[model samples]
Target: MSSTDSSQLQQQQQQLAEWKLQRLIKSLEEVRGGGTSVITLIVSCKDQLTRTSAKIAEELSVASNIKSRQRLKLYKKTPPNGLIILCGEVGDDTTSRGKERKLLVDFEPFKPVQRSFYVCNSAFHLDPLRELLTSHERYGFVVTEGNGCLIAEVQGNVKKTLFRLTASLPNKHRRGGQSALRFDRLRAESRLALVKKVAEAAGEVFLQKDATVSVKGLVVAGCGDLKNELKARLDPKLQNVIIKMVDTAYGGEAGLDQACDLAADALAGVRLVEERRAIGSLLEAATREDGAIRHAVFGTQEVTAALRLGACGRVIVWEGTELEAVTRRHAETGEEKVDIVAPRVAPVVQTERDGGGNGGGGGWEELQRVPLIEWLDREVAAKGGELTLVSDRTPEGLQLVRGLGGLGALLRFGVQAEVLESFEESKEDGGDGGQERETRGGEEGDDGDDFF
Candidate 1:
C-alpha cells in the first residue's frame, strides 16, 4: 500500500495493542492464584518466538487452542516491541480450591521488553510490564535568570542536565564612578545574549537528529521575567510548544529541580486538554442542527452502523468506557452472532470474563466479550479513520461519556444516522471489491491485514 495507508494502519495497530495491554493489566491486578498455577512470560523483541514457544510448548498446550491458535501463529516472526503473556489456571482467591478459572492474555508491551522472563507464581508478574509502559517522551526545561542556567531533558522519570552555564555579565563597580553607567549597558546586552544562548541550547535538547521536536512539551522556569524573555528568544516552532513559564527562587540546577515540581500541573493538564479537544469537536458536530449536512453520530449501535455503511470516520471513545465487543448465541436456535455493547450488569471476569460470557439461564445467552476499542480499531482502520480515546476528567469528556453513550464519530460526509443504518448495500463477490467505500484522498485501501 501507499505510505499514508501504511502509517494509518500502524497507528490503529498501536491503539489496539495499547487497549489490550491496559485491559489485561487492570484485570490481572485482581487475579489470585496458586504459587505454581498462574504463568507469566515476557520476551524481548530480540528473542526468537519460535524457540521460546517450543520451550514452553508443554506449558502452553493446556491453553484453549481456539483462543490461542492465531495469537501463537501470527508471529511467524516476533513483533518489533516483543510480547507479554500471563496465562494458566487460577482460583477465585489465593488458595487452589475456592473457584478455578482459566486466565490468558498476550500482547505487545508499550515499549520493547528489555529482557526475557518466565514464572509461575501466586500472582502475575506486573512490575516489569509497568516499567515498560512508562512513556519515553521527553520534556525540556530551561531554568535560568541571566545566570547559572540549567537546560535539561526528562525522559520517563530521569532528568539529565544538558548544560550548566554561569552568566558572563559585567560586574558593577562598587564606587559611583563615571564607568558605572557603562556597566549597566553592558549588563543589559549580556542578559539578552544569555537568553539567546539558553534558547539555542533548549532547541538542541528538545529536537531530535532530524530537527523535529522530540520533547512532548517545554517548561521555562526561573525567578522574574527572564523565563518570559527566554521563551521569546526560542525558535517559533519551540515557542509554540512551550507548556508553561514557571517561577523559581533560584536558577541553575536548583531551579531545574524546583521547575519539575512546580510545572507538574501544567504537564498533567496537557493530556486533559487534549482529551477535552477530542471530545469537544465530536460534541460540536453532533449537536449541530443541520441534519442533512451533520457529520456527527453517537451511541454504539448508531456509530457501528455508520461505520459499516462506510460513512463515519473519526471515532472518539471514553478511555474508561465499559463497553465490550461480544458474540451471543440464540437461546433456541444456538446461532452465534457479534455485538458491540455494554454488559447488562457488572462483569465477573478472568479468561471467560471477556471471551466466554454466558447468560445464567437468561433467554439471550451471551457468547464472548472483546474490548469494544479493538472492534472499532478494525473498522476505523479499514476506512482510514482516526480513533481517539478521551479521558473522563474534563467536562467536555464527561458529556461524551455520559451524554454520547461513551462513543461518538464524525462522518466523512453529512449522512443521517437513521438513513445510514437502514441503507443495505449487497455484499459483492470476493473477486470484486466487497464493500464500496467513499474515496478518502485516494481509493480506500482493500488490503485487509488483521491489524490486531
Candidate 2:
C-alpha cells in the first residue's frame, strides 16, 4: 500500500482500538471485588512467559486465581505487544446475603507495553492502562510562592522539573527600629524581581526557539496569588492553554505534587473539552436545520440511516452504549440487512431465527451480532467519517446519553427514521447503565439533577 493508504489504515485502527478500550474501562469500573481479592497482572513483551506462568500458579490460593491460572494457560505464547489479565470475585461484598461472582478479563493492547507488573487490591489497578489511553502530549506545571518556584512538565506517566529557583523575600527587621515604609518598599521590589525571574526562566523551559509554547497545555499551581502574577508575564501562547490554577498548602516540590492532585480533574477533562465542543457544534446544526435536508440527528436510528446512505459527517457515541449490532435477513426475499438491537431483544431475535424464521409474517432471521462500539467505528470509517466516544463525566456527555439516546451524528443530508428503524429506540435505565462505585470517589449519591 502507498504511504497515504497506510496512514489512513493506521488511523482507522487507532479509532477502533480507542472505542474498544473505552468500553473495556467502563466494564472494569463496574466490577466490585471483595476486599483485596482482585488480581491485576500486566505482561509486557520484555517479561518472561515462564516466570509469569509460575507466578499465576503460585497465586492459586487467592480468591480468583484458580480460574485466572487456567485462563492464562490458554495462551501458549505471549502476545507481541503484551497482555493484561484482571480477575477476581466481584459482587456485593458488604452483606452475607449478597451473591458471589467471578470475572476474568484478558486482552492484548494495540501498543507495546514498557514494563510488566502485578497487584492485588480491592479494586483493579487501572492506572497502567489508563496511561496508554491518555494523550501523550506534555503540559507545563508551575508551582511557586514567597519561598521559591519550580517549573516542570508532565507527559503521560512521567513528571520532571526542569527549572528551580530560590527567592529570599524581605522580612521586617524586628530586632532594630527599621522603618515600616522602608520594609514595605523593599518587599515590593523583591516581588517585582521574582516576577521577572520567573518570566525569564519560564521562557527557557516552556518555549521553543520559534517563540511558541512547547507543551500542549499548561497548569499553574501554588500557595497564593503569586503564581497568578507570574502567569501574566509568561508567553501569550502558553497562557492561552492554561488548564487550571491550583491552590496548594505549600511551595516547591511538595506543593508541585499537591497541585497535581488538586488539578487532576482539569487535566483529565482536557480531551473531553474538545469532544464537548464537537457535541455543541453538532447540536447547533441539529437545532437550526429544517425539513429533509437536516444537518443533525440524535439516537441510533437517525445516525445509522445517515451512515448507511453515505450522508454522515460526524458521529458521537457514549462510552457505555447499550446497543448491539445485529445482522438480519429477510425470510421471504432471502435478503440480508444490519440493525442495532438492544441486548435483551437480540437473543430473542437469534432464537426466532434458529427455530426457523419469521418477518413480513415469516420473520427476519438474525444471522450475527458484533459489538456495537466496534461495529459503529467500522461503519463510520467505511463512509469516510469520524466517530468519537464520550463518557458521562460532564454535563453535555450526560445530556447526550439521557436525552439523545447516547448515539448521535451530524449529517451531510438528512434521512428519515421510518425508512430505517425496525423497532423503537431502546430506553436506557435511569442514567446508570454501568454505574461504578470508586473507592476514592465520593459522588455515589449524586442524581445529576443539576446538569439539566
Candidate 3:
C-alpha cells in the first residue's frame, strides 16, 4: 500500500463521482419543458456524513450556477449510516446573500427575476418535507407525451433536476451497490428522454393550424402502467386542461377519445349549438346578396370588416389557433367560401325583415358572440342540427363534438330573419347592464372570482 497508489485511487473516485452528477443533470435537461416552473432535487444517503453531504451540496450549487437563475432551496437529512438532500426554488427571490453571489453571476437571467433563497432543514420525515417543498407558489406539474406514464413536479429558477418521479431506488436491484447506481441513473435518463419527446409532439400539434392556440390546460386521462410516464412527458402549458383521470389504457387513439368524452360530458345541459362548414358557406352567400358586397369575404380585407358589417354570426376555429386575427385570402365570387354557409348568411337576411326587435327576452333567447368553435354549436342549433356530445346514453341521438378541440356548429334554423337585428339590440343592452354592475362593484371593491 504505497502513498502514491492510495492517492491515485482517491483521484479516480472523485472523477467518477463528478461524472455521475453530470450524467444526472443531462437527464433532467432531456425531459423537462414548459410546465416546469422550478427544479427540485431529492437525494437520499445511508448516513448524512457531513463531508459527503456537503460535497454533494457543493456540486449542486456549482451546477445550478450554470443553469437558469431559478431560486434553489436545498435540504439535507442524515441517518445513522446515510443522508438525503432536497433542492428547489421559492418565491421570486433565489439569490445567495454573500459568498454565493459570484458563483451564479454567469447563469442566464430568469424573466421576472429576483433574489434566490436556499434553506436547509434537518427533519427526517420525507412526506411533510416533500409537501413543504412543492407547495411553493411556482409549483407547476410536469409531464411528457410518450412512454405511457410518468409525472414530475419541478421547482427552481434554474431548470435543475431536483426531485424525480422515482424519488428512491430499491436496494434489491443493486448488485454490490453498482447495479443499484446504474438502475437509478438509467431510470432518470429514460424519463428525461420521454419528456423531450412529449414537448416536441405538443408543440407540433399546437402549430398545425393558422391560428395560435395556447394551451390553457392539460389533463391526464385513464390510468395504467404508464400513468406517471405520460404525466411526466406532457407539456407544462397544457396543465390547465387537465380535468380528470380515468383508469384505462385506451392507448394512443383512446387518449383523445377519453379527453373529448370528459370535456363534452362536463359541458352537457349547457344549451349551445353546433355550426360546421355549412354555416360558413351560408354566411358567405348572405353577405354578397344583401348588397353589402363589401361584407362578403372577397369584398372585405379584414375579419373586423365583416364583423362591423354584421356579416359574421360567429367564427369557428380549431383548438390551438391564436385569437389575435384572421389572415386567409378572400375567395372569389364563386370561389366557394371557406364553407357552405360562409357566403350565404348575408343573402338570407336580404329576403328576411330587419330592425325587428329592440327589447330583450321577448319570447326570444339571447344570442351570444362567442369563440368560433362555440359559434359552431350555435349554428348547429340554428339549423336544427343534432347535438352530439360524449355521454353514457347512446340512444340520446345527438351529434358528438368529441374531445377538447372545441369544434361546434351554430343553431340558426327557425328564427325569422327579423330576429337577427335584435341580437345587436340585445348586445347593446347587455353592455349597458355590464357597465352598471362593474361601476357599482368597483365602488364596493368586489373581489369575487366570477367575471361576467
**Local distance difference test values of all predictions, in order:** 0.66, 0.69, 0.31
Superior candidate under TM-score, 1 versus 2: 1
Clashes of each: 0, 5, 134
Which residue pairs show backbone clashes in model 2?
358-362, 358-363, 358-364, 359-362, 359-363
Q: If both were scored by lDDT, which would come out higher, candidate 2 or candidate 3?
A: 2
Rank order (by lDDT, best first): 2, 1, 3
The worst-scoring run of ten residues by lDDT in candidate 2 lies at 429-438
Ranking by TM-score: 1, 2, 3
Residue-level lDDT of model 2, residues 335-377, one tens digit each, is: 5556566553523322233322343445656566666777778
Taking all chains together, each candidate's TM-score versus the true structure is 0.55, 0.52, 0.21
Off by over 4 Å in 3: 1-178, 207-218, 222-236, 258-264, 267-452
After TM-score superposition, the amount by which residue 261's alpha carbon in candidate 1 deviates from its true location, in angstroms, is 22
Model 1: weakest 10-residue lDDT segment is 430-439
Top candidate (lDDT): 2
lDDT at 447 for candidate 1? 15
lDDT of 3 by residue, 1-452 (tens): 69865664453333233333333333223221122323332323332334443544665653364342232222233332222233222221332333121111112211111222233322112342323222132222223233342322212211122222222213225464656777777776765565555545544543336544333333354444344555555555454455445554443433433433444444222111112223344345444444322222221122222333334443333322212111111121111111112211221111102211242212211122222323333443354333222221111112221232222223222223344344334333432221100000112222122111
> What is the C-alpha lDDT profile of model 1 across 44-122, one tens digit per residue?
8899887777756665544343134345676777779888777666644444585566666777776678788876677
Model 1 bad stretches (over 4 Å)? 1-5, 48-80, 94-98, 101-110, 140-227, 230-277, 287-292, 329-341, 344-367, 379-384, 393-396, 417-452
